[model samples]
Target: MNSNRPGVLILSHCGFSFLEDLKEQLQRRQLRCFVLTSLPLAEHVPARLEQIQVWADRLYTADSHQLKLEDVNNALQTLHKSGEQVTCCISVWEGYRHLMAAANAALGTYDIDAQQALALRNKLNVRNQLADAGLSQARAHALTAPVLQTLQAQSARYFIKPIHGIASYAAFPLREDTTWKALETLRLASVEDTVYASAFNDGLQFMAEDYIAGQEFSFETLLIDGQAHVVAIHEKYEVTETADTVLEDSCTTPPASLDQAQIAAGLQWLEKVLTCMALRWGCYHIEARFTGQHWDLIEINPRVGGSLISHSVEAVTHGHSMLSLWLDLLLASQDDHAPRDALAQQLNAFQWQADGISAQSVATFFRVYFAQPGTLSSVALNELPLAPTVKHILLKAGDVIPAHAREVFLGQLLWAFDRSRQAEELERLAHLSATALDIRYEPGTP
Candidate 1:
């Protein structure tokens, strides 16, 4: 609340579980951190809520589940009335990007423009925009009742997903036999009254796009004033399709599947794709498929990749996490051109080496597990043949799993390996981890 200190406003949905780590990093740089969230206080775990209250300089909770521009503006007005100066606004949540943009606009700060933020939320809009520019190979259409019949008659397989969705909710493959009734039923059962409902802020419109078949990968990129820098590339080792959504189970860095020549070509293609989309600044988790000769667009997420992606990137990139670098970028945006240019040059020169471990010799891999919809009785790791560097248990006993059929994480395990043995070690460890881990549910619950 000191008027002389520069403040940062963070817009969040649900809850930011990693506030302590973020606060510590910001505090070291003499930045005051304030949180404005749309998650109702009653929904928070008592212990987690206490940690949030203790870490943030100021906390504002909205009565509603979804944050809007009016809510952000009101909070800004209150801060101004108190003689506080908020220099920048940021959010890692994909659904609240537009609200973050709005807040920055009101404060005369730096962020993606409001129109571009809104355009990124719609899947069909993104596909059409990129396809028109020859950046994407997929063709997409809005899923309406009249168009359902036409889509069914087509021979090409389609991927059905919400226009504005997160956590892979309500995403599945559409076969020739797929029916509109089944899609509607799944939409209601998965989205309505579920924890993921707030993510569909732009309504429940769905789209069907031609399914691009190839090996899946994600590029973690950082943009500095319209220039793209590739931080790391992750190859999805295992991708499982559930009844309603696709689950990315395991990932490895430096993509074991692609050669250096392909990697270089993919980076060139990605630069063009980002430029065509008009994404000038911010962190992007761009997902795509590589069909041997070329790459196809899957989706572009305007935030850090979720579920230990930041951790893996930090391990390989000299302890520089995406969140930390992103904060540095935002803070630098407020400075004059000389300082900004210097920081950008430093970021651009980042190399993948840390603590004597070269990126060419080291590899990081992580595996995520999901549980079925039911009442959780227990989740435990009985034994570990290969010790992981980091392990996180997300759900505990007596936790009731929602029936939304989304990716309900049970736990995650991350490990570091020598690049020479990465493939063999990953397979062996994955198999062992699966057998040693135990997850049980309450009887007669589904």
Candidate 2:
């Protein structure tokens, strides 16, 4: 590896807090980071200036919301002019995965299925791809006016959501009988309603897909040359489901409920789907549901798992960084000596062991959501027998809580618990939600 060559180029769109941790970790390994972010430099730049100054060797900003190919190329050329080289580029955000792939392809360091990148963002397209590959069991229909009208008059149950979405936002289960009523009730919003900033102008398109009934799990994986390596399996916990919406409450690693056979089956399905999609290199956070007899694909994202899953992975695995592994993959893509063989050899070295993660430790992350819309008066957590590792409070006492049709959380808590205390912790947390965690609100017009 050339000393003057750049170590990694990070394409960041939003200021996710975890990116700071990732950058620091990568830099600790003597890897220099260059950042190309599409976020407006005026408004969002000041907040992250400390991080940018500390971790980045060079920083490039795009004037617009979308990262243009020309802009990336220009930045690469500028780096070359300054006697710097970008060996690998990476992003953990879903919206920027395509951009990262495009940049990688342009650099000729590694190849990603660009078409698959586009297809992965749209849920309907993913469903179609899965069905075509004989990798999915569910049927999905686009939510056109006619289709909604027909579904309104039928006896089918389905789930409907934006074609491109994150954090289960705007996703709801639809019943055939109440489909028309639900449509009338659903507030029509555009791309502007999205939580993260994006360049997608494709106004909200919804898909009505068969809602598979079973236990849901996420397979955190790394793909090298389209080969899927399972890092960890996560058990998804949902806030008590209402008729219309489902929101995530917690995610635990090691999927305690899944048997070894079921875990093997889930990995097999993951590999097949990754191969079918031709995702050559990157991190994947794939969600799936398993019935007793069959498995259904929920969604497959060509990025690292969101929320605190990455943190939980490290906590459970005793400091093994999944993001570091992904960065190494990118760096290996630019190797002069045995590129493919180097990647393969590195993959083997970091291969995820079935027993690598400790069984005695269980890592869990919980999302805190407010039920009432008003000015938040106060929030207090109940004392637990075991203290949490990380506590991120996203809202303060005086923050205004806007009314949302679907449940939106205020903050989150990350905990690494002893296996023996898992059940007790869950129960205590639930009880605390009802009694100890006081979320007082000053009523206002919603």
* Best of the candidates, TM-score: 1
Each prediction's whole-model lDDT (CA)? 0.78, 0.67
- Model 1 scores a C-alpha lDDT of 0.78
- TM for candidate 2 is 0.84
The reply for model 2, stretches above 4 Å from the true place, is: 1-5, 40-55, 176-188, 194-201, 240-245, 335-374, 377-382, 401-409, 418-446
Per-residue CA lDDT of model 2 for 140-197, tens digit only, reads 8988778888776766677887687665655788764545445444535333344342
Q: lDDT tens string, model 1, 274-298?
A: 8888888877899999988788888
TM-score of each: 0.92, 0.84
lDDT, residue 316, model 1: 67
